[model samples]
Target chain A: MTTSDSSPTVRTPLYNLHVELGAKMVPFAGYDMPVSYPLGVLGEHNHTREKAGLFDVSHMGQAYLTGPDHDTCAAALEALVPGAVLTLGKGRIRYTQLLNSDGGIIDDLMVTRLVDDEDDGRLFLVVNAGCKHGDYAHIAAHLPAGIHLEPIEDRALVALQGPGAAEMFATICPEASEMGFMTAIRTDINGVDCWISRCGYTGEDGYEISVPEPQAEEFARLLLAHEAVEAIGLGARDSLRLESGLCLYGHDIDTTTSPVEADLMFSIAKRRREEGGFPGYGRVRSEIENGPKRIRVGIVPQTRAPAREGTEIQSNGETVGVITSGGFGPTYGGPIAMGYVSPEFSSPGCEVDLIVRGKTMPAKIAAMPFVEQRYYRKPKV
Target chain B: MSNIKYTEDHEYIRVDGDIATVGITDFAQSQLGDVVFVELPEVGASFEQGEDAAVVESVKAASEIYAPVSGEIVEVNTALEDEPTGVNSDPMGNGWFMKIKLSKASELDELMDEDAYKALVASQS
Candidate 1:
């Protein structure tokens, strides 16, 4: 967790804002990102569960894919991912992953089907910051004629997430209150054109606003001025997502990890699962039918000591798995982790030992989202 | 406080005759941020100067507390095992890690005094 200093890193639009709020800035994914603020990581984590915490996620890549119509555009994207991009409804967002030919995840992203008829063929994508350039190039290279993938470079992405987020949004963006989970809208905020999504990495009911670069700081300040919102940094962001059982791109899911093995089969559309047109369809289909050899699962250490990343997991004294992301869960009440283990040991209550500093600590395979997910979903009648 | 000596690693040693109370400095606790857990050495354990004696875990990382001088652990702070926030709240007082019976009282001469430690901390920022 040392700050990178050898090479210069770029800064986000909120760099000055973070500094103004006394943040501990560290180089992350080629950007000078804020890791924590004066509120502290633990305080920020708890705050987001009780109140809205604003996070600057501008480093993520935002792009637009355009074609003759939804059919042509979906076909191009479907070739790379297993998600049902073709069936996505207007204004609805679908979470998917970019796959290599080997059934490995290149990156996980959010794809939104635009609402306006003029933007009929357009699909908006938000990808991981570190893999954005590669993802864009890969998508562009694979696109058929008449389709275009344009990277939106001048935008700052921010999230306001928590239990109180909806109440806060109801006062400002009244339309947001009626939004279902994973829905988005393009609207003007104080005359500033923005894209708002009723989705966030933290499992709480919240929204992500994409503000243009010039007005980003002003927009961020506007939210910070609200009593319900407090500025959060990357430290809490990691813990929040970890507690939510969500995957972090490089840490939890990498190019070598497939969706099935990563326990992200939900993202694979049922139609795609049956039709199988994606790049790694063969392996994905086989894994779906036969089950993956290793399965990702949640880990809860029995002791106060956390089993951090790279901690070896042993069952009956034989090594069975390794932790990918582990830390103190401020909201979950104790140490929580997620990692891959042999199939037989992947069930909840399956006992395991975490070897930390040569000492074996007892743990169990617990169910994910250590804290139950609180996403706001519209009632189905 | 006048009898206290400091280490470059941000440990404080308060000497009373041949016995000393050892804990992380307030500066170190602040730098480490939130403290989640603390692993203390057993009372009978013996350690050499610079050897790992205890472990402290923050939310993001695990750090070792080295033995500031060659000594035998006389007492361990067991309260921290159940409530580690003491490391952040009163790190210099109730958050003390251990009490050691020095094998060689002369080893204290090698540690930084109050003025020198303050200067070292000042230089860092």
Candidate 2:
């Protein structure tokens, strides 16, 4: 998204590092972000799947919620989202969406239950860069009297992702090696105080490190010094997430889209479903049972031409839906897209036509993650 | 040797008699990042100057390639269909998108020469 010229662009602690590496910087979410490095988007993308790629995600909002105990804090957050936050185990993370009263997603975020006894009644949150301001306001307004939400503005976030990510992170903090998917721990990295999570948006086995702003650059440099780690930009991040079939905040899932319609029903915990008290619970539950009018699905075009965002989708000469995110999948070696279509037309192998620049290109509804997810989970005892 | 000319939109044309070969400039390809696919007009297709003639898609975004001059397409580079990266590796050679039988050879006078095109590129950056 383009920012108005009047508003000064914000820079993360690693901004200078990106410039030193000769990255192509562009405006994104009111910040001057690195879109790609000198290695190019395709090269950077392939490197991440084969090695570890470090991404500066400092633009995201990190916050803490404190209350009397776990129950009080969980109830405060539960009032804003439909996820089973109250039942989240200590040191564990849950993926959920903040919804408006109408059941539309305000933002998708990661909620972690802290383990420290001193912060026994606290929860940690990481929200999207663009929606963080509005999300923080919403949380603060609905917060109960005892519970307080504090935005951690002095911290910077970075994601080390791909197959080699865990190994690289292990070399820095060995204790992180034992963490399973959707888990978090607070540990020091080379003397830098940090909060590390064994989770990422790329659908790969990775870690997201939250370091204080002062030590962020030094910490990033330490990770980049590792042979398996290379600097990645937003360009590769988008492609990697697309290949993983994960939803982008404003694109694939937005305020106009519900979790069920966006195919994110898995995030709705069984307990929340049975006892519905969350926002848009009635509409979401109804859609979960009877199905929504339209649902998001993976689209594979039969031609070399890519059907980009806003491309219209039609079936048998009648328009059914539109593409929300589409691009040439470097990993897929061809064009891949995701879009919304009527429930009757969302089944895999169903043929549809993508009206690209007024030409109808043959496409089919396909199962997502177009690539297999490689998340690492500990074996159950 | 053919006479070469350039357009402000970063397209280049190599003219030999009334036939002209067209492709995007090196500057355009660099700005486009990695070229993954190219949608070209078929042989014998007709287009007017500034009309949308082709689409070049990179891993990052899709861009429109416009007709540099009015003409009828005489040949298309089928090689790019398989090796789209040719646009990034050899934009001026095998990356040529199409050849057109110019409807008016005088249209070449309106295009920029090598020196003028280089200056335009310099001003842009």
Candidate 3:
């Protein structure tokens, strides 16, 4: 859909900070966001790898879903997403996608069973910035009478991600030092009550802190005060997520693409696969048994030249697919990308060619997480 | 350090009779953000006025550099292969993209002066 001029585009609480930092701002997901800072996309990509990077993810949707009891709410959520919500222990989080009736991804989101303050049975949810409004509307419409979807529009999200992220957060929020990856807690940080999730999109050990909008600027400042945290923008965010094999909505996956076709079958639990009640269950089930015609795979360009979005993917001198995302991967030390390719050529180690500026450059289909994902997991007690 | 003439597309040309040293304007580099790679034309390659002569790629986008006037490429900045950032760091000096032997001497008259170029930038901004 075209981004309408009249559509209400919300700005993150840290919008001013981006302008102050001389960030090159552009419209993304209905928000004016900084694509990069003076360090530029390349330097910013490298900075996030070598040190901690502070990203203003405030534009991401933060919401809460509550039902009469934990069991009911968990089952209600599972009906919409593919995750086994009830099986999740308290303080644990799962990455799942909100799907349309056709079983196509509406948006990728995180859901955590929060420690109910009043025993009200609440589930903390975070969704993509671009799809937040539609996600909320879709969930609200599908939810039962007792189930309620509350949009926390006034909250701001910040992702402090990288190798140095854990240590940096530990200095400010000591309680979080013990938290493991995909685990979350409603904790106080420097006197501000916030929800801290030990998760990030950067393929690094990091935390996504959800703070009240009013306190966001100060919290960002506090994080930046640490030596390791450099301000990162959308440019690095895209590159980091791409390197991690995560899909970006509108570019990689959309309402037209199914989870199975997108190579996101890992997200669908076995129970859900068999029960087959979700929208487009038959289509998704068939694709699961019979592989999709084209699958998303990682492409590592043999040369330094980047094969950007829309560049054709060719095999045996014939166009098979197109690149959806690509750039210089600082961690990989060369150009890396993700694109759709015919199933016959989708296997890892498959050779392909990317038609970059009319020149066919040799590339290989590599297994994703081109770099190792460094999620922080607690040691076995 | 010579008097530079500017083109509407933001290229800058410094001419001394039949030879012209060419590079993108400071405005162009700033607009492109960070230069990462440059595809320079072969030294002996001949091009007509407004023909695609080179390519400059930044972190996010790429643009073609069109020759302001028909000319024969004499030299290209090989330094850009290793140090494309030089264009953002020093657009007019060591970052000079290429030098060309002008096929038409009076074509320089069609370019703009610094004042006119600055006015164009101001109006656009």
Compose the digit string of candidate 2's lDDT tens values, residues A74-140.
Answer: 9889988988999999998999999998899999999999967777889999999989999999999
Name the better of 1 and 3 by TM-score.
1
Query: Candidate 3, which CAPRI tier?
Result: medium
Q: DockQ of each candidate's interface versus the true one?
A: 0.80, 0.88, 0.50
Question: What is the C-alpha lDDT profile of model 3 across A1-381, one tens digit per residue?
Answer: 113265666678999988898898877778888888988777888888888999998988889898988889888888888777878888888988888888788999999988655644789999988888899999999998899999998889999999899888888888888998899888887777789999999898899999988999999999988988889988788878888888888888888888888888887889888986677788888888987877888999887677888899998899988898887676786678898998988888988899988889999999998888888889998
DockQ class, candidate 2: high
In CAPRI terms, model 1 is classed as high
Off by over 4 Å in 3: A1-9, A117-120, B122-125
How good is model 1 by TM-score? 0.98
Per-residue lDDT of candidate 1, residues A1-381 (tens digit): 224466889899999999999999889888899889998999999999999999999989999999999989989899989999999999999999999998999999999999787899999999998899999999999999999999999999999999999998777778888899999998887888879999998889999999999999999998898898999999999999999999998878888888999999989878899998888888889989999888899999999999998999999899999999999999999999999999989999999999998999999999999998899989897
Candidate 2: residue B83 lDDT (0-100): 93
TM-score of each model, in listed order: 0.98, 0.98, 0.93
Model 1: how far residue B122 lies from native, Å: 1.8
Q: What is the C-alpha lDDT of each candidate?
A: 0.92, 0.92, 0.86
Candidate 3, residues B3-102, lDDT tens digits: the string is 6799999999988667888999888998887777787899999989899898888767678899988899999999998888899888988888888898
